[model samples]
Target: MRARLLDATLELLVERGFAGTSTTLVSERAGVSRGAQLHHFPTKNALVVAAVEHLTERRGAELSAAFEELGAEPVATAADRRTRLRAVVEMLGDHFASPVFTAALELWVAARTDEALLAAVAPLEQRVGRETHRLTVAALGADESRPGVRELVQATLDLVRGLALASTITDDSARRRRILREWADVLDRELGKELTA
Candidate 1:
């Protein structure tokens, strides 16, 4: 029952921002009683937090799968690393094109001012960084202790968020592509290697 409520809340949240979605909509979407929704989440903020977590889980799975695909490839050189990174960037770009990002951003913006939400979503952000770093290290056999590795990781995540924001207004593929390429190039240079292309 709780899962259904959260999933429905997530969908509605993406479709409608925090202020636009309500308990009635959630109950209607989930085909549950208002009392049931209340039992699970006494306030809309609680539901929004749960929805954020659900979206985090979904994106985490997508990112994990992309990393798995990268690992399935044999990357032997800097050029190989660039190829994998670009593939990853493209996959991440596609995933963020969904409506979920808008809601996530809305929640993040709200979290900046709301201590409760900040408490809820902080772990999700940490998990994303840790998971991305682990996957990159595993796939490339690169020790994360290498200099600039943390910067590369941060660049990757920032670009992911930037891609979502850009896609909201312009629908420009060029921005995502260019940033991803540049970040990959920077990482490659830091690694003291050259790309084939």
Candidate 2:
């Protein structure tokens, strides 16, 4: 029942924006009584924050699973390593382009104006930033000991976020793919053996 409410809240928050996602709407969509909704979440802020956290945790688990699955297969050659690195970039780009990201964007935008919301979301956002960097480092075999490698990974994330935003405005898939491919090639050339490790 709580899961249903959180899921419904997530959908409504993404579709309606923060101002439009009312408690009543969430309860109605969840097919639960208003009393039940209040019983679980005493306030709208609580509900929205819980929903955002739930989605973030879910996405984080997905990323961890992908990493584990890839870890099971060893890279046989430099060519294979390059391929795997590129695949990681593509996977990260796809994650940024997902509905989870869109919903998180909505929350972020709303939080910009609401101090209470900002307070609630800032820590979650920081944790996500740290987790993403750690995962990217592991996925691409990035050598943080190298001067520019960490920054390059961060740049790649920023680039993908821009691409994801563009996708929200138009069908930017083809262009996004092109940019991702071009950037991947650039990283391969610049990072050299570090990326292939």
Candidate 3:
């Protein structure tokens, strides 16, 4: 029941944004009573925060699996590392374009003015950001210890997220793919230079 409500909340958040997603809609979609949802979440902010956190955790685990898969592959040389870095960029682009990211984006927008929601989301957002950077650095075999390397990796995430936002409203999949590919090549050159230096 809890899981169903969370799932319904994420679906509503992605489809409706923060303004459109209501407890009534969530209850109806989840096939649960409004009373039941209130019992579980208590408030709209609570529900939205919980839902975003749920999606983030689920997506984060999938990302971890992707990083593990990268490790299991035979990356024996600098050339192989460059190839893997490109794959990681591709994977990050896919993740940013997912519904989970859309849902989280909704929360982030709403959190700007809503102090309660901001308080609820800030720590979770920090943790998510940290884990994402850590996993990306690991998967790319990038030297985070190097000056500017971590910031460059973080810049990669920001770039993909902006692309994801653009793709959400436009018929830009082909263009988005092109941009990601080009950016991957750029990351490989810049980051690889730093890591090997």
Query: What is the TM-score of each predicted model, taking all chains together?
Result: 0.81, 0.92, 0.92
Order the numbered candidates by TM-score, best leading. 2, 3, 1
lDDT of 1 by residue, 81-174 (tens): 6776667666666666667667677777778889999998888967866876676556544555766666666666677777788887777778
Task: Report residue 146 deviation for candidate 3 (angstroms).
Answer: 2.1
Q: Which stretches of candidate 1 lie over 4 Å from their true place?
A: 77-79, 192-197
Residue 75 CA displacement from its true place in model 1, Å: 1.6
Candidate 2 per-residue lDDT, tens place, 83-126, comes to 87778878878888877887888899999998888887889988
Displacement of the residue 51 alpha carbon in candidate 2, Å: 1.5
| Every candidate's lDDT | 0.74, 0.84, 0.85
Q: What is the C-alpha RMSD of each candidate to the true structure, in Å?
A: 3.2, 2.0, 1.7
The clash count for each model shown is: 0, 0, 0
Candidate 3 similarity to native, TM-score: 0.92
Query: Model 2, residue 82: what's the lDDT?
Result: 66
Q: Between the candidate structures 1 and 3, which one is better when assessed by TM-score?
A: 3
Please report the TM-score between candidate 1 and the true structure.
Answer: 0.81
